[model samples]
Target chain A: MKILQVEGLTKVYGKGDAQVKALDNVSFSVEKGEFIAVVGASGSGKSTLMHLIGGVDRPTTGKVQVDGKDIFTMNESNLAIFRRRNIGLIYQFYNLIPTLTAEENISLPYLLDRRRPNPEKLLEILGLLALTDRRTHLPGQLSGGQQQRVSIGRALINDPAVILADEPTGNLDSRKSRSIMELFKMFNRQYNQTLLIITHDEKIALQADRILTLEDGRILRDEAVRA
Target chain B: MWLSKRALETLSQNIRRIVDGESVDLLDNREGPLSILRNDIQTLVRMKQEQADALRHDKERLKDSLSDISHQLKTPLTSMMVMADLLETAPPEKHAELVRNLQTGLTRTQWLTDALLKMAKLDADAVAFNVRKADAREIVARALEPLNILLEMKGQDVRTAGEAELTCDVRWTAEALGNVIKNASEHSPAGKPILIACGENPIAAWISVTDSGEGLKPGQIARLFRRFQGDGTAGYGIGLPLAQTILRGQNGDIEVDGSGLPPHVAELTDEEYSGATFTLKLYR
Candidate 1:
């Protein structure tokens, strides 16, 4: 099933003279369990496109339907709840709560919903990420590689449908970056999680199941990887 | 010419090092030229400052570029996370694990982006507070409220004393106290007593969470709030730093007395020594 659909998406900021087109008439669809990468230069509207699809920002003209629901149609309060329950977002700096341990960070989504975290499932992900031993430590204590793993666990805590990562390995060294990508692969293979990542690094982008290139607020290319 | 002269001076210093313990000094001329050389050294320092100023400007520009790149990556990653999360709730079976992983991965990325953003914001001096009069005891309760279940689950208890009312930002103060209490709850074992006391001293309003956990060794006391510094754990090492940030933002502070004050723990049970106690102070 098509998990995400974006049609005629255009995002414009400011008015007439000062206005900038962040995304212009962009359209795309993503399949379930696909690891996709959106690549673009600094000025490209790729990030803007990602924001529109994520429901973090509304497009000036277009529709983005995730699970067949128009997110922009919802109110801000509902959107916050929806985003928390459905989305898992990761970034380069590993935004685990500074005070929360690995376990707490992983369980944050569920905790937000006022539910007890599933220890069994949490332990499983912690072990997979090799963070079981460091479960009690704060984000400040973990190595870059370990901290990223905790972030992965936090995203997984909700068991959300899709994971959106932007330059998840940007801060790590090559070794740590590779290991993080490997973990992404492990998740794709083991759990069949749908992933859409934004990356500047060519190697990182190439590893995606599909590549979508954006330039000057437009989609330049979108293609699946060959076996 | 000036650059060349400085280079020559540096060359002579290297040559002096090579002179095998001889009484060699750059300005030690037999003509009593030390005073003149000192004046020249002062002039060189002034010249170097001008050059260093230019380098500082370049460094700031590079730092700005990196910050921009980080934001560029972060903005989209956040959106993608929302999209992935929305998609995760789709079909029940076809790509369950894939969906789970995507959501998880996205969350991880989002967190990292948040830290970078916070760091950038801190660097940019964008983290300002709206400090006001508030209650200290109430703030502690509010921060501890979320973790009440966890405390209960661990068979732990918390008590408070002193007037709850004081002056500070309710949210920021709560956040600081939350960190201290949460740290105590997580590090110490179950069925132990964790005490949170709030009172006003002559200097500042004090709030302290004393846990009956293994006390910190002399080593852990130092480098306590350093970022990414932890005792082999999964955290990003930002709690104490963040607490410090929040407290400091409110013109308050946090400290640790791995050897905390007495009465706070004199009658404590044996299980309470596994972790250390932390105290926070804020202005009235």
Candidate 2:
């Protein structure tokens, strides 16, 4: 099933001559459980593309269909729910609630759904993330790597249809980076989870099942790896 | 009687010195039964001091653990209460969002509680491993089964070679291999093949899962198996470590060689990119 579809996606910042087309006429579709890596240099609108697809920002012109529903057509409130329930967003800086403990941040999506998190699933996730001990530690108390894990936990907690990560491992060292990639792969395989990651690292990009290279807000290449 | 009084006085002085954290040489100038008494007292004091230190350390650890638990619980509780208050006064349109936020808070608290309980069990070594002889191919098959759907979605294939019979707790070993294979499969690109080669020697049985992805750097290879050692990129640093623990319990070990070419060039190489090769070895 095609879980995410982006068509004619465009986002302009500022106005007139000062207007910046961060993402210019970008169009792509992601299959369910597909692991995609988006790579581009700085100022190529990589983050902008992510934000538009994530519904954190609206596209100036275009359509985004998540699970066949036009996300832009929904009202702001409905979009918020859709984003919470279907889209799991991960960032380089983690963006965790500093005041909340690791476990709280992971379960935020569930809380947003006004439902209880499944205990068994939660335990499995904590075990998978190796966060059993750090569950109680606040983000401030956690190391950079640990905080990112919590953020990833938050993203996975909802079992969203699509996980959109922007430089999810940018701040991590190579070991952490490898582990993080392994984790994304684990979820993609174990649960058939769909992933769209934006990264600048060539090595990281190459791990994806499909590599999408963006240049100046346009897709320069969308190639599959031939074994 | 005079000698006995003198000995009593020395003993009292030595006890005082020990209590004050000062060193005392009780047997330096003594001989006979007095020296023996002095040696016994010194041993007794040393044992008591060690016990006190251990107790103090445990107490400190317990204190930190309790504080962490309370703080973890409090944050969600506080957030939920705030959300509930907002919900009460929130406009009808805002109520749904607030309710969602409120529920998220409760869910976090619940997850934390459950995670803590499981962690406690793992810490207490409450999980028992059932070790027995099993077919290595069967173990690999079981491990790869869950990932079949994902592999098919990615248009990837896992190829297994060689076969060996080994003594292991099939379930736990499979779980460990599953994690390793999952890691390898994720790093490998679509259409790329993940190779699982099994072999046995006089002393051990081994399986190596290799992927054609960007191999790990030297530093990364060093810390790959450490628990909670994520680089803040993707993982919580649990799976591999758990796999390690499981293997270790079964008299087995995991090794990774990430010295292969970069992931991009790995595709061009006939040697499977060497991005990473995780080898699981179990002693016979």
TM-score of chain A of each: 0.96, 0.96
What digit string (tens of lDDT, one per residue) describes model 2 on residues B179-278? 7887777777888888877866543577778887777754576576655554566544455766776776666667566655333223333554556778
Q: Of the candidates shown, which would achieve the greatest lDDT relative to the real structure? A: 2
lDDT of each: 0.69, 0.75
Q: Residue-wise lDDT of candidate 1 within A14-69, one digit each (tens)?
A: 99799999988998887656889899998798778767777788889999866445
Docking class of 1: incorrect
lDDT of 1 at B59: 84
Q: Please provide the root mean square deviation of candidate 2 (C-alpha atoms, Å).
A: 26.9
Which segments of candidate 1 are over 4 A away from where they belong?
B1-284
| TM-score of each prediction | 0.44, 0.50
Model 2 chain B: weakest 10-residue lDDT segment is: B261-270
In every candidate, how many clashes are there? 52, 9
